[model samples]
Target: MVDPLLLQLAAAGAAIVGFGWLALAMDVHWEQAQGQRPQPAPVVRLLRVLGSLALAASLGLCLTADHASMAVLVWFMLLAAAVLTVAMTLSWRPQWLRCLWP
Candidate 1:
């Protein structure tokens, strides 16, 4: 089995990167998908898929490190961390996370 600390850290990193990929997919920066820089649809699709896969991997890592009950707890904790990452990014970097529209 993998070390619990490693699993936990991996889970947290995966969650954050997953959220970042998702945010990029939606072009939350506005500058990424608009007139001066129109991102390709395939790239956006890939980002979305990667985001999901990363989140899934986080759960897999947690499950590998512990029993089912502990795995479930870790999974939910990672989920909460992921949500917090998104919220904090939106709150702290509103300029970087501007809507696609005006």
Candidate 2:
């Protein structure tokens, strides 16, 4: 089995990317990050799929690190953290998020 700390860290990364992708799928956030008006339909679709998969991967990693009961709680906390991080980044420095995709 992988080290719990490593797995948890990976989970955090996946969650952050997941939320970031979800935010970028939105026109406003995409414009903020991409400096454009409206994202392409195909890119939006792909982003949504990738975002959901990343979130699922994050949960899987969390489960691998802890008991199922605790994993759910931990996943939620991680999700919250990821959301805040993404939101703050988007608000303050959306260009940083460009690295996530571009």
Candidate 3:
């Protein structure tokens, strides 16, 4: 069986990566991270799909790591943290997000 703590950490990482991908899918955020380049439609769609899958993976990891109620609550909290981390990274230093897409 997978270690619960490891799974929790993986869940958090996945949530962050998921949010980063989703943010980069947006025109404004994409421009911030990868300036002057034309945003490709196909890449945008691919990023959106990958981001959604990562989020679902995070939820799955969370559920596997804990009881149902706790897992839901923990996952919600993880989402909040992930959103803040991505937003701050975007505003403070969006170039850092390039790693997510590239």
* Predicted model with the maximum lDDT: 3
Once fitted onto the true fold, the runs of candidate 3 whose alpha carbons sit more than 4 angstroms away are: none
Q: Judge candidate 2 at residue 54 and give its lDDT.
A: 99
lDDT tens digits, residue span 36-80, model 1: 567688878887898899888888888887898999898898888
* Alpha carbon lDDT of each predicted model: 0.73, 0.94, 0.96
User: How would you encode candidate 2's per-residue C-alpha lDDT over 1-102 as one tens digit per residue?
Assistant: 689999999999999999999999898899899896557899999999999999999999999999999999999999999999999999899999898778
lDDT of predicted model 2: 0.94
Error of 2 at 94 (Å): 0.5
Error of 2 at 51 (Å): 0.3
Give a tens-digit lDDT track for model 3, residues 20-66: 99999999999999998888999999999999999999999999999
lDDT of 3 at 31: 97
At residue 39, candidate 2 shows an lDDT of: 74
What TM-score would candidate 1 get against the native? 0.77
TM-score of each: 0.77, 0.96, 0.97
Clashing pairs in 1: none
Model 2: how far residue 50 lies from native, Å: 0.3
Clashes of 3: 0
Q: Which stretches of candidate 2 lie over 4 Å from their true place?
A: none
